[model samples]
Target: MWEYTDKVKEHFLNPRNVGVIEDADGVGEVGSLSCGDALTLYFKLDADGRITDAKFQTFGCASAIASSSALTEMMIGKTLEEAEKITNDDIASFLGELPKEKMHCSVMGQEALEKAIACYRGETVPKPEGNIICECFGITDRQIEATVRDHHLVTIDDVTGHLKAGGGCGKCHEDIQAIIDQVQGKPMPIRSEAAPLTNLQKIRLIEETLEREIKPALHQDGGGIELVDVDGNRVMVKLRGTCAGCKASQVTLKKTVEAKLRELVSKDLVVEEVRS
Candidate 1:
C-alpha cells in the first residue's frame, strides 16, 4: 500500500470533470487496463485558442483518478503552450506529493495531455520511436530512455515504478537494467561462470564483493552496508546511515548490491535488507 496525501484522497474520492466531452476539440488516450492504469483526456478551446473546458475518463487506482482530475483542472483557461509546460512533477506537486511507486499515475496524465495537444494540432501523437522492450507493458526503449532522462531514475525499480517496465514477466529485467546503465553512463555488469560453489566459498565471495565493490560505491552517497548472513543463495545485509531510511533502499539493494554480487559471486544470489 502507498500513502496518499489528503488532497489526493479528496480528488480521487470526488474527481472533478469526470466523463468526456462529446464534441471535444482535442482528445488523447494512453495506457491500458493490462498495465493497471489508463487515462482518456478531452479538451475544448475557445475562439482565442484558450482551453475552455477539460475533462477525463480514467481507469486505474485512486492515484490515477486523482492525477487525471488534477490535470483537467490545471488545463482550464491555459493556452496549449501553458498546458504543455505542465509536467508530471507539476501534477504531483498540485496534490502534495505522490508515493514513489505511484509516480506513473502523474506521468500517464502528462502523456495524455501531450497526446491531446497533438491531436488538436492535427499532428499524430508523438510517440518515442523504438523497439518494444517490455512486452508486458508495451514500453519501448525510447520511452524508457526518455523517462530515465526526465526523472533521473537510477534503478530498474525506479523505472518500473514510473513506466511499469520490468514489473511483469521478469524477462525484461535485464533489458531494463541495461537501459538504466546506459542512461546513467555506467558500464555493463560483468558476467561470469555459473558453476557450483561451496557454502564457505559463496560466503567468502559475497564478503569480498561487498568490501571491494559495493561498499565504496554506497559510501560515496553517505551510506554503508554490512553482511549479516548468507543462507543458501540469499544474502541478508543491513543498510546503514541515510541508505537505511531512504525510500530508494530497495533500488539500491537490488540494482547495486545484488547486481554486484551476481557479477562477481554467483548468478543465483539474492540480496535482502535486514531491516531492524
Candidate 2:
C-alpha cells in the first residue's frame, strides 16, 4: 500500500453518507467488480435545483471508498451546473493527494457524479469516441488520450499510475507507448500493417472484452452473464443471478452486451441468449 494522507485515512475510517437517497434526482454508477472497484453515487436536489443531500454505495479498496466519501461531501450544496465542473484532480486534491496508482479511484468518483447529473437531465452518457485500448481494464483510447493530454503524462508507467491502462497483461504497452508519443508530438515508431486475427485470437479478445467491459456493467445491477458459445459470428450467452429472469434480459443482451461486443470485437458479431 502506498502512503495515505491523514485525510484519506480519516475518510476511509469513517466514510460519510454511505447509503442511498430513496427518491434521488440523479444517480450515477461507474467502475466494475471485475476490475476490483465500483461506485454508485446518488444526489437529491432542493427546490432551487441545488444539491441538498448526497450519498453513495461503493465496492472498492480504501482509496476508492475515501475518494467517494470526499466526493459526496464536496458535491453537497453545489448546483448541478456547478458540480459539473468537479474533476478527478479536484477529488484527489480534496483528499490531499492520493497515491499515483490510486488516481483512478478519484476518476471513478468524478465519472459517477457526471453520470448522476446526466440522469437528472434525462440525458444518456454518450459513448466516448475511440476504440478500447486496455482490454484488462476496459479503458478506451479517448480516455487515455485525454488523461495524457490533460496531465502531461510522459511514460507508460505514468499513464498506468493515473489510469490503470498498462497495468494488466502487458499487451497494451506498445499501444500505450504509441499514444504517449503521439500526444507529446514525439516520433512514433514505423510498423508493418497488421494481419487479421486468428480464431483463437478472436476468442481471447472476446473473453477479455467480457471480463473488462460486459460482466462488470451487469454486476453493477446485481446481474451476471457467462459466455455459452461462439459460433461463426454468433455469440451465445446465459444470464446468471439477478439477470437470469429479468424481463429486460434480452434488452441487456442486445443493447448492452451485443453492442459492446460489436464495438470492441467485430461489428459482425451477434449476441443471443441461451437459456440453460
Candidate 3:
C-alpha cells in the first residue's frame, strides 16, 4: 500500500463528493494515459455562477482517487473563476503532501477540473492534436516528447503513468516500448522474451479458455473473469461479475487459472490480478 498522508487517508476513507449530480451543468472525463487511472467529474452550478455541487468517480490508484475526492471537495461553493485557479499545487497542499512519484496523480485531478470548468463556460477544451504515438492511452507524440524532455521520464511506465498513453487497451505497448527505446538510445524490455501475442490472438485464446474451461465453472457460482492483457508471459486479468469482490479470488487465481496458465503456457508465466 502507498504511504498516504493524513489528508489523503482522510479523504479516501470518507471521500467527499462521491456521487453524481442529477441535473449537472457540465460533465468532464479525464484519464491519465500512462497509469490506467480515469476520472469523471459532474457539477451543478447555481444562479450566481458558483459551483453548487461537485462529485467524482475515479478508477485508479489511491492517490488518483484521493485527489479526485479532494478536488471535488475544494471546488464546491467556489465560483467558476476560483475553481479555475485551483492548481495541482493547491490540491497537493490541501493534502499536506503527496509522494513525489504520485504528484502526477494530483495533477490529473487538476486538469480534469479545468476541463470541467471550460465545458461549463462553453469554452473549447483543445483535443490533443499531434502524431499518434502511444495508442494504449491515446497519448500523442507531442505529449510524449514534452513529458520526456521536461519531466525527465526514465521508463516507459513512468511516461505512461504521467501521460496515461500506454496504460490501457494494451494496443500501444509495443509503440510505447519503441518510443522508450528511441528516447534512451537503447532497448528497454517491458516484456520477457516469450513469443508475443497479438490482440486478436490473446482475445481468441482468452475467449476459448473462458468458454471451454473457465466460464462454465464460474457460471455455477455466478462468477466470471475478464482477460485484460497479455504482456509476454505476464497475463493481466480482471475479475468481473461476481468474482470481483469475492474473498476467494486469490485462491482462484493462484490455485486454478494461474496454475493452468503456467501449465499450458511457459512455466515462467505470471498471472496478475488487477483490482477495479
Candidate 4:
C-alpha cells in the first residue's frame, strides 16, 4: 500500500470529477492499456479562454488516481497557459509529496495537461518514436534510454517503476534487462541458486526458448505456443486451439518445455500454462 498524504488519500477515496463532461470544449486522453494506466481529461473553457471547469477519469493504481484528482482540482479556474505550466513537481508538491517510486504518477498528470493544451490549440503532438523495447507497455527504446540517463537508473525494476515499462504483460522484460546490463557495463548476471534470474529475464528466456525450441515442437503437434508474460519467476505461456484440451499439454510444459528452457537459460524459470 502507498503511504499517501491525508489530502491524497482523501481525494482518492472521494475523488472529484470522476466522469466526462457532456459538452467539453476540449478533451485529451493519454497512457494506454499496455501501460496499465490511462487518463481522460475534459475541460470547459470560459468566454475569456480560461479553464472554467476541468474533470478527469483515470484507470490505474492509487497514486495515479490521486494525481489525476489533484490535477483537476488545481486546474479549474486557471487559464490554459497557467494549467500548461503546472509541472509534475508542482502536482507532487501540491499533494504534500508522493512516494519516490510513484513519482511517475505525477508525471502522467503533467503529460495529460500538455496533451489537453495541445488539443485546445489544435496542434498535433507527435507519436513517440524509437525501437519498440517494451511491447507490453508500448515503451520505446528512446524513452527508456532518456529516462535512465536523466534519473541515473541503475536497475531494470527502477526503469519499469519510473516509466511503467516492463511492468505489465512483461514481454519486454528481457530487452529491458539487456539494456540495464549494457548501461552498467556488466555481463548479464549469472543465475545461481543464491541470485536467481529476475522476472524480466525469465520472460525473455521463455520467449527465446519458444522461438528456438517449443514453437517447433507445438507446430509438430498441430499446435502452437504464444508467449504471454512473466510475473516474478513465473512464465505464463498460452496454448492455442488444439493444444488447449490436449492431455499432453501438462507433460510438454513440465518435462519438455520447462526443462529445456531451464537448461538453456536460467535454472530459476517456472513455466505455467495459460488458456488462450
Which tens-of-lDDT digit does each residue in 197-252 have in candidate 1?
78997798788677656765787788888899999998999999789999999999
lDDT of 4 at 102: 83
lDDT of 4 by residue, 159-243 (tens): 8767778877778888887776554453333345555656666567667566645665676667877778777667788887577
Worst 10 residues of 2 by lDDT: 186-195
How do all models score by TM-score? Answer: 0.66, 0.67, 0.53, 0.59
Tell me the lDDT of model 3 at 7.
Answer: 88
The candidate maximizing lDDT is: 1
lDDT of 2 by residue, 38-78 (tens): 99999999999999999999999999999999999999999
What is the lDDT, from 0 to 100, of the residue 195 in candidate 1?
A: 61
Residue 144 displacement in candidate 4 (angstroms) = 1.7
lDDT of each: 0.88, 0.88, 0.74, 0.79
> Which stretches of candidate 3 lie above 4 Å from their native place?
32-35, 145-158, 165-276
**lDDT of each residue in 59-112, candidate 3, tens digit only:** 888888889999988998999888889887688889988776687777788878
Judge candidate 4 at residue 200 and give its lDDT.
67
Show pairs that collide, candidate 2: none
Candidate ranking (lDDT, best to worst): 1, 2, 4, 3
| Candidate 3 minimal-lDDT segment of 10 residues | 184-193
